[model samples]
Target: MSRVSNMVAEFVATFPTTLRPGVLYVSGAYSTAAHLCCCGCGHEVITPLSRAQWVLTFDGTVSLRPSIGNWTLPCRSHYFIDSGSIRWARRYSEPEIEANREHDRQLLADARIDTPGGRHPLIQYCRSVWRRLRRL
Candidate 1:
């Protein structure tokens, strides 16, 4: 796929229902960043902001961490969004894709386990119920 050289960043409170190619729409209020597929496939890509997910960095230009891999798309494009440029990454093999997917799943699980405040909601609820039963 051809590299996208002319990307522009826009900040909005709410993302537009319709996305336009070549524009990265960022919404800190909503904690999301979106853009059309740089592969010119016309697919809308929305990256949610989270510690375990994509992080948008803006320093006069916009960049996204961990790259965007359109694995489910027909195009299956993989690239990095950095400084208003789309740097194409080499296509991954099936095994590589599966490994990456597993890595992402593990990362999410770790994040949930390591949440700052306390144990995960389910674990906390279980412990609370156990304490109440013991008190009874």
Candidate 2:
């Protein structure tokens, strides 16, 4: 698909109810970034900020280190967000995907953050519980 070449970053305290395509919503308060799939697929990609995952660099423009690979998504788009520009990357095969997964696993192990989506399992669980309690 002919994808959009550029993306706009918006700072938000909290993610909105929905994400707009090509608009990267960066929330420093949450240390997270969210956006629609750049490959024209409407999947919401939530990239958590962490040592084992993406490292966001924002200076007017934004760059997310370690290109994003949507292995779980059907589109499986791979690209680098460089200075608010979308740099499309070559598609990875299943074997390559497995290798990438292994690399990610090693990074997670080294960082001792073994939860899914690069988040601490206990922390997320506790946060969820607290949110639930707040709702009560």
What C-alpha lDDT values do all the predictions have?
0.77, 0.79
Assess every candidate by TM-score.
0.79, 0.78
In candidate 1, which residue ranges exceed 4 Å CA deviation?
A: 1-3, 116-136
Identify the candidate with maximal lDDT.
2
Query: Candidate 1 on 1-136: residue-level lDDT in tens?
Result: 3446557888776789888888998765556689889998888888866667776666778788888999999999999988888898999999999999999888788977888663344444434443553465
Estimate, for each residue in 26-113, the C-alpha lDDT of model 2 and write its tens digit. Answer: 7655667899899988888998776677877667797988998999999999999999999999999999999999999898787774
Give the per-residue Cα lDDT of candidate 2 at 71. 95
